[model samples]
Target: MVTQRSSRVRLEWGPIGADRIVEPDCLAVVVDVLSFTTALTVAVQVGAEVYPYAWDRQDLGTYAAARDAHHAVGRYEAQRSDSLTSVSLSPRSLAVSSGLKRLVLPSPNGSTISFRLRDSGATVVGVSLRNRAAVAAWLDAALEDDPARVLALVAAGERWDDGSLRPAVEDLWGCGALLAGLRDRGADVLREASPEAHVALAAYDAVADDLEAGLVACDSGQELVRAGFRDDVVDAAQLDVSAVVPVLSGERFVDARRPLGE
Candidate 1:
């Protein structure tokens, strides 16, 4: 659908929208609030570089070894007390670990989307409600430096039982949170936001009072809770808690506390 491109901030629902909107000059912010982006924020906060990898890939060990990074294991595998690997996609697991220099995190949603945009020459940043304000400030500064480039917020939704993309409310809320943060800074950046971004902002406003409760009730949140990951849902709902912004540089995501591309 939205084939015509514009030099403004846009909100894309899932991979399809990402495929349609992402360009060489666009800046892509991947939001996977339920887990991936949240975990990335946590990892980057502790001074770790994260490499986004697709979950379906079997050569992750080789890929991690090539990059001198540690490949993350599944949630169950990472939870074992005797497990040697400290890397995992689970935010709760990563929050407790320290001294990890590099990590290869795999996910079907956010990582897959990040991997798709790797060669597009777009500056991809992993964001969520946790660091929405920081990312918003960073993006606002970026826009001030170069108004010609567009920013696309891609909400990496979950997959359904039939393998169709099921848009998750948590990500929509996360996108809206970032958009709201940008608007709070000044209207100059807000003026560049597309209608879809406004809609997401409106959605966030409707549930801002009880963000954690809302996440706990969402489909993706419920799935995580059923899988014994309610803590992750709670962590993802914390708005503006982190100051770290994970920006994709070279092959891994680094903390962008300083100016981007520096």
Candidate 2:
């Protein structure tokens, strides 16, 4: 209970934080700016039904096959191949993939957290730097609809080589982007935002002038760059470009612009 940051809005890092903060009355927003959620936003923008999967799931391809969806590949895997059979967790890949109606996206960070949070009794929403403003607007409308609903912004930080949480700054910035945008949407929401949420808002204010630069200089960005995926970082650095609010309905993330049933 103490770790839940009991307030109208809260900000926390990693999967453990996600478990602590979310409940049936909470709107859990998962932010993975380096790729997962960014890719998710792009997929949803193109009207694709996205299924989030565990990062360690060995049956990702099998799952996608059963559902007749494209199993998202790693950027390196997609880049190394000439096959047009699938897209990756890179926003650029999903952005260019035509007729992408269904996708089973997996990741070490965002997808893992998202998959686990599906039955957590909270309304899970996906966000990244690209669609923070649109999601904030959606959140404002959501607040109006259910005055009792609370917010939990979870930063799905990366993992170290040993598979431990690395607390990536890119995700922190992504969470901050959403925090500041939501605060700008309404005054009431700010009143009960946790202190940790304010800390994230402060970070957002610091990077507001140069989000692209922030992403370009972060450790995750450098790693992705060395791996030949700098374009993915740039794709996620954009702000408010997408109005697609990815809401978790059943096991898939459907764009909030359309009905969840669709």
Candidate 3:
């Protein structure tokens, strides 16, 4: 059983931290800047509904098939196979592709956190640097309508060599971007923000001048570059480029800009 806290806005890293921070009244904003959230943002912007699932699950095809969605291949597998690359977690690929109505995006960090929050009775929204501003605006609007509700920003950091949560700079930067956006739109929001939130905002302010350069120099970004996914990192670094916010509804992610029923 998770304990509910009284904070208005908080920041936490990875699933373990998120599990402790999330509560019934809390709204979860999951940030996986390296690729998962970025790809989901791009895919939703292109009218594709995404389903998040654990990367370790080998039955993602079954899960997708049950929902009549297509399961995306891993990044490395997609890179090796030209035909599969389009459905992979590459933001550029998903941004340009069409006819994929539903997709299952598997990730160890973002997807796991999202899945854990699915039944926590909280509204889950997938955010990245690409859609952070828009998401912050949407979140502000939501809070304005219900000022009592709490919000928690979870940065899904990459895993280290020992499978521990490695605090990836890209995720920290992404969290900072969202916090900064919220702070810019609503001063009162920051006044109620937790210390972690303030720290993330400070981090974002520090890298505001050259976000791309900061991402390029990050360890996770360097690893992706060496793995030939440098374009993904570049795409993820484009702050506020997307206006669409991917909100998890039911089992899939849909554009929050639309009406609830529509």
Candidate 4:
């Protein structure tokens, strides 16, 4: 009997920078379960071709008007402000649709990361627990084609009064898991990862089932559950499905690009 060895993989965790410049040479995987990425993964799985627009407040009106958008959608952060109400809303279906013929996204954190990476030389992909498996497979194919030197993992967070708003550890847990799987398969290419990656992976493993057992534990996960999207979360964590890597092309997420496998 022969035993397979675990492939060595490395990953790093960090925040989006000011310019939020995403290195084009590396493959980027953006994860935000709170809403945008979560909804994006679900919507793609649900058959909606998601097109992400700029999160800049000024850009919203222009895009909405040009697209003949009927509704404008955003997060509680933007809508909570007295002046931003005209363009913000909760992360609901109506908010998802907003008033546009197509979806116009202005999220507090997720959209910012997505927009920044909009033109990186490397391919940008959306990920959440729901499409983890699919993403892993997609990554495998990318590695087979051209191994990446840097795999940037961005996590989104809330805005606080003291500028101390950082992404939740729960969010990192998922990223760590992805990093772990990437390393396990030797697909991350660069062989660079955070020392804490294993720690985060173990923590998430301990509470992986909490996604179902404690529905209200995580803010975004809970929000989706309350919004009647529990099924989305359950499916999001499945690990692998289509193996179709979802990449960001301009403003839309296109899966037509086959994995390196094909």
Better of 3 and 4 by TM-score: 3
Q: Where does model 2 exceed 4 Å of error?
A: none
C-alpha TM-scores of all predictions = 0.93, 0.96, 0.95, 0.69
lDDT of 3 by residue, 86-182 (tens): 5888787787787988999998899888987888888999999999889989998888888788888898999987999998878888888998888
Sort every candidate by TM-score, greatest first.
Answer: 2, 3, 1, 4
lDDT of 4 by residue, 67-140 (tens): 55433455444445475334332323433443233455556566666766676675677776656666776677
User: Model 3: number of clashes?
Assistant: 0
Span of ten consecutive residues with least summed lDDT in model 4: 1-10
Question: On residues 108-173, what C-alpha lDDT tens digit does candidate 1 reach at each position?
Answer: 899888887889889999998999899988988998899787888898999998988998888899
Whole-model alpha-carbon lDDT for candidate 2:
0.87
Candidate 1 achieves a global lDDT of 0.85
Cα error of candidate 4 at position 60, Å: 1.3
Give the runs in model 1 whose Cα sits over 4 Å from its true position.
1-4, 79-86, 258-262
Order of models, best lDDT first = 2, 3, 1, 4
Q: Model-by-model lDDT, in order?
A: 0.85, 0.87, 0.86, 0.55
lDDT of 2 by residue, 156-197 (tens): 999988988888888888888887887787647878888888
Q: Who is ahead in TM-score, 2 or 4?
A: 2
So what's the TM-score on candidate 2?
0.96
Q: Model 3: which residue pairs collide?
A: none
